[model samples]
Target: MTSLETLLRNTQDVKVIDRSIDYNEYIPLDLSAFNPELSKFDIKCAVSFEEFIEKHLTLNDAKVAFGGYNEQRNLYQRSTVFKDEKTEERNIHIGLDLWIKARTPVLSALDGKVHSFNFNAGFGDYGPTIILEHQLENQIFYTLYGHLSLDSLKDLEIGTVFKKGEQFATLGNAAVNGDYSPHLHFQIIKNIAEKFGDYPGVCSKKELPFYLENCPDPNLLLKITA
Candidate 1:
């Protein structure tokens, strides 16, 4: 394992969502093209897609539906942001998603200062996003929180310090959060490269290897297992 991965794994009790919800209540959700169930729903519509999420949670008897790291999904086909005639479709999701109802409390994964934040307004884009810069074991990295409520960005400033588990934001609904189900798109970025508030959460197959290396699996920190 790399130094960053080891540092993340060595940490304890990391919860980015409501602290009251235990990891046991979190269930894995498959939004990939390989999931045959996705074919049944008109996922392009946020309302319909949300209904599907609600049903999935109900059936599994879980509170939160999570996953989608390095998952290739067909859901992005409706958005020109992921694909246009000139570029290859960016269908692979590189972040760990925590699917839940809107306005759920979002916490900081570790003590860090705000590197950047923005309202990336677009279809299939991260609505309100925040990236926190952290340093551990003399290594600096960043954690990105996407699909946040607008209120989360209110009164925010650069270099804002947030302690681990501190409530810094709330989840955004479909109307604001890229017109999809309410979820926190969390990623661990080793190198941000001049990007502010926003980073490419989806990548084409051709660019997968680079992204996969730069953005490691967030589960190494969350450790929410099956």
Candidate 2:
């Protein structure tokens, strides 16, 4: 089978906080307009992305984009880890963002272990992040949840066990989560490079190709409108 087929085969139905929609549900927002390169103006026209896409946006657009490749928008692009002097330009967004209000509960899409976690704080940072590892159809992979409340990772133990569709964390607001509109940055990583709690959600133009392969569209697992 082809990689596309593999991805389709691996796609899983995620248990949303209180999902009322059904399969192949039509999301409210037309985020196809949310390309990585678009300026704040373009993004706001769509909806206020809790992180990179700044400015005022409306709630008409619910159910944010999960995973799908785009050449313009960097989900975590504007988040800064520290003072500008402390780090270089922040550009890469390593995960798929689920745009919504803060405090939304994030659920585990599959049975897995708490592989690792940390509070990746900084300007435009992840705030609190969690990574869960799963073995579906004998395929070993991981899911990374970023932009969560600090309390979310307070007592999480690495390698701790969590069942599929479990409640793990809640979406945080801009004050706690990396400075952005409220949203959950979801990502699937094949190899974590020994990294815990934090990973590059976006990559430079030169590195896009590699990051794309390393981080597949989370839609495979979440089945979100990518």
Candidate 3:
């Protein structure tokens, strides 16, 4: 039996997202065409890819605006969109997002139970989301899979058990997927404590250290190669 950490550090041909095909060649899609307000989503995806290229990029005081968009950003006062204020503070993305086309199979990272699921709809939102809870050696953790097709969550029920490496659902496109490029928001949470169908994937820079502690580098497990 391979340990989770071993699976993560495994330099051998290990499958990410459970049954996800080895997407050897992939090209990013332009979600801006669908919704200009979603420009920030594209921006975040671009920055994340840039950081992925650097391989060890970590910004401490970097600023990331927090707000979902259906069209284009309104340039809301430089600090907030509606009410939440943070000018020098940008919304820090905690999850590792994969930008690509839709309908890509979403695989189970490990044998876990379907903790909860929901449809978080809104421009720049996670249209469809799913969370899996896994426990090893009494240490439990959860993984959130987001930006999926609406059909993906239509009939899903809570507490459903998924075996490790199962094909759970497919990635969604801009229209149904919160009006952004097709991608997967993969995040790890150490202590969900008591949450259902929802968890924070992005946080303010003010709460970075805590988030960093709670949400470790997913690449530590992804080992992505371009």
- Whole-model Cα lDDT per candidate? 0.95, 0.64, 0.61
lDDT digits (tens) for residues 105-195 of candidate 2? 8888678899888887766677788988887565677888888888788778888887777788888877777666677878888778888
Better of 1 and 3 by lDDT: 1
lDDT of 3 by residue, 13-129 (tens): 423342434433322322223445344332435344333322221222211111121212222222232225434433556777765447767877777889898888765567799
Tens-digit lDDT track for model 1 on 129-223? 99999998788999999999999999999999999999999999988999989999999999999999999999999999999999999999999
- TM per prediction: 0.98, 0.75, 0.68
Q: List where candidate 2 sits over 4 angstroms from the true fold.
A: 1-8, 20-71, 74-94
RMSD of each: 1.2, 4.8, 9.3
* Number of backbone-clashing residue pairs for each candidate, in the order shown: 0, 22, 6
What's the distance in Å from true for residue 165, model 2?
1.3
Best by lDDT: 1
Ranking by lDDT: 1, 2, 3
lDDT (C-alpha) at residue 17 in model 1: 96
RMSD after Cα superposition, model 2:
4.8
